[model samples]
Target: MGTFQIEGGHQLKGSIQPQGAKNEALQILCAVLLTPEKVVIDNIPDIVDVNKLINILSNLGVKIQKLGKGKYSFKSDALQLEYLESEQFKKEGGGLRGSIMIVGPLLARFGKGYIPRPGGDKIGRRRLDTHFEGMIKLGAKFRYNKEERFYGVEAPEGLKGTFMLLDEASVTGTANIVMAAVMAEGETTIYNAACEPYLQQLCKMLNKMGAKISGIGSNMLKIEGVKALNGCEHSVLPDMIEIGSWIGLAAMTKSEITIKNVSWEDLGLIPATFRKLGITVEKRGDDIFIPAHTEGYEIETFIDGSFMTISDAPWPGFTPDLLSIVLVVATQAKGEVLIHQKMFESRLFFVDKLIDMGAKIILCDPHRATVIGHNFKSTLKATTMTSPDIRAGISLLIAALSAKGTSTIHNIEQIDRGYENIDERLRAIGAKIIRTA
Candidate 1:
């Protein structure tokens, strides 16, 4: 495992660009299986999970060609439908939750699909019940093998559309079902579905490939099944998680930074939430500019004039994935803010590390915490840290960068799983960070 040695107290100035959205890129790459024609994707992120998915695709005979920087052309023709059981495929595709999505297109085109249990961040109990349930509703039969931990599906007569409502607002579940329904026999209506931007982008791309979809941005999606999907070029949106990371990085370091190519319209409630903590985000055209200084930005209290609390919720609410970074940034702010991570229970456990660094934080159970901003006083003490999860790892890096001295962060391979060239990009912004084993 590699480690990151960071020297702190550096004010990061200058600009940096974010890579393509990781969530969107995964879904788009899986969608290539829907067609045998060449599909070109631009702005691909050089992250670990993406590379793993690419290997899975290549194992299944999907021709992946890297044409240029952040650009790839993929052709799913000559795919080996039975290659899922090969040792190479099992090792690479076994635990990636994104790989299970290939089942939808495989069953649609080849009458059968096999998938091992998909693996991803063990943040919480993520079940594939919804994906299989949606496929069942579309007239597919599924069987599970306990010994192999694999799922096999067969749709000999092909999938036929049916109206169904998801049990929860599962993002991958919704994407899998939507892909299968697009090639079904008739119209399919999905209610209580996740309407995140990534799913919306997938729908838009599928529509461009001759699929008719209604209610694009709403909870209810109506898909009129098409016979097949053809190749189309689509650009993935900027990762909102990366954008939030930048926002936190600037506030913690007290640096002036500008994020370009950001979709301001899609940033629902992010600006307002950060504004509550006294961080000024200036919007000039499509780019967002953060001012250099943050001396007097008071953390806003509640409407009844109580300590302010920011919580995560579904779409149109503050995202849970960013609450960790926000919490770290709040530590250096002026006043107090309560952070509530409602979705995952154990996410806030890392607050102990921040507390050890001299931040005033109270762990009030697993779901909530009260943070008192330090006003950049009693500078954080350097120490060795280990990454617990993807977002938390990045937050730890930001905190270390703003600390008073040098700190070592181990298990950097976990950090590389998400952020693309994070050290190099941070270095560009005048941060003193280096990657070493």
Candidate 2:
């Protein structure tokens, strides 16, 4: 296992660039399978989960070439369709949650797609029902192998588009269904569709590939199915989650940090959400400049004088991914805030480590925690902990950076699955973090 040994109590300076969206990369890379022409993608984040998906594409016989840093050219002119049935494929595909997305394009183009149970952060129940159900609504047959925990979708006679009201606006589920429906016969209408920037980029890219899709940034999408799609160049947006993490890090460590090229227009509720916690998120020409919180920030209560409650919801609300960072930043603020992580039950479980470091936090339940800010009256004392998931790992790292002593974090691979060269990037900005194998 890899580890990060960090010396706390350092103030970071200089500007750092946010990496390309990891979630978007997974969806965009899979769309290459929809066409046989060359699809060139730029700004691909160098992260573990994305690299695993790229490897899976390679194993499935997509010709890939690295043109430059974060740039690749892919051609799916010839693919090894039988690889989907191999044991090697099953084991490889199961290692990544993003692998579930590949099935959609494969089914649309090759008439069949199969995958064993996929794995990722052990946060909660991340069911595949939404993904498979969307495809099934488009006239695909679904099968599950109970013994192997495998899922399959087949549409040998081609898919026919139809209207679907998604059970939930699951981002990946909406993305998978859209990829499959792009080439189906007639039209496909999806209501309650996820309109996160990740999905928006995918839809735009599909449109560039000659697929007719509308309702770019809304809860409903209309698609006029085309017979086929062509390859197109696409670039990913900067990861908003990482951008939010840096904002939290700056607040916790009293550091002045500038996040560059953030594509401000697409950051729907992120900046305003952080400002509600009393963090200063200044918008400066598409760059976010977070000044050092030399004076510790205060939590803003409701107009009626109740404690502030920060919660997650579908897009246009606070993202569930950044709730962990918000919870950590709240620990050092001047007032109390209730963190309701409604999406994942166990994401709030990491607060115990912060409590051990002398932060005041009350774990209300599996999905909620109340954090009482120390207001910098007491400095946290660092200790050892293990990373449970990507967001929690980064939150703990931010805590350790603002603490009083040295700290060690094990299982940093979870952190690497999202953030690219996190230790190196943080070090460049004056953070005392080292990665040891």
Candidate 3:
């Protein structure tokens, strides 16, 4: 395990570029399996999860070449289908949630898909029913091995497109179904699909590769199956979650930082959510400039004079990924706000760590917490803590950076799973953080 020792109470200043969207990259990377031609992807973040997916691809006999930094070419001309049934594949594919996405494309192209129970952040019960049920709707025979904890799908008669109203708008599930439908026979209509920028970009990229998809930014998507998909080039958008995390860090530590090339149009409701907490965000071209909060910031109450509630929903709503950062920032805001993490029950439990750092927080339930801002009146006392997940790890890092004295955070590998070179990037902008093994 690695640890980060952060010396807090420093004002960071400078500009940093956000890594390419990790979520989008996962979907895009998995999309490469839809075609046998070379798919060149740019702006791919150098993170652990992405690298693991790439390694899985390589293990499956997909030809991979690193063109440059954040650039790669993948050609699945000789995919080893037998690898999917191998114990080695089980070990590799079971390590990351993104690995589950390969099932859709593999089933679409090769008539079979197999996956062990995938793992990711232990935030909530992320069921795979949406993914499997969506595929089954498209005429695939689904089977599960209870003893092995494995899922298998096969469409020997080939997939035929059909209309499906998903039980919920699951991002990965939607991406999986779309990839499977792209090569199926006839037209497929997906209602209540996830419309996040990640899925939007996936659709756009698929279209570039000869798939006909409509409704780029809406909850409903129409796909006209194509005989084949060719390779195409794609560049991922900036990581909005990381962008929001930087904003929260700047606010809590009173730092002035500029996040470059953020694709402002795609960051729906993210900036506004931070603004509700009284953070100043200026848009200069494609960049979001966050000025230092020297005069302190206040949380805005609802018009009805009730505590402002920050919650998560599907796209166009405050992302559940960044709610931890918002909760941390609220610990230093001038007023109290309720954080309702609707998506994940255990996500808000991290508030206990923040409370231990001398912040006033009330954990109302597994999914709700009320944060009363300390307003810089009581400086956070640095202490040792273990990071629980990706977003929570970064939130704790932000809290550590804003606290008085030094703080030690173990289990930093959780942070590295998503954020690319986080310690190096933050250090360039005056954050006093060191990574030690």
Residue 398 CA displacement from its true place in model 3, Å? 0.2
lDDT of 2: 0.94
What TM-score, computed on C-alpha atoms, does each candidate reach? 0.97, 0.99, 0.99
Model 2 TM-score relative to the real fold: 0.99
What's the lDDT for all of these models? 0.87, 0.94, 0.95
Instruction: State the displacement of the C-alpha of residue 66, model 2, in Å, after optimal TM-score superposition.
Output: 0.6
Clashing residue pairs, backbone N/CA/C < 3 A, model 3: none
lDDT for each residue of candidate 3 in 307-392, tens digit (9 for 90 to 100): 89999999988789999999999999999999999998888877788889999999999989999998899988899999999999
Q: Which window of 10 residues has the lowest lDDT sum in candidate 1? A: 292-301
Give candidate 2 regions above 4 Å deviation.
none
Is 1 or 2 the stronger prediction by lDDT? 2
Q: Itemize residue pairs with steric clashes in candidate 1.
A: 95-118, 95-119, 96-119
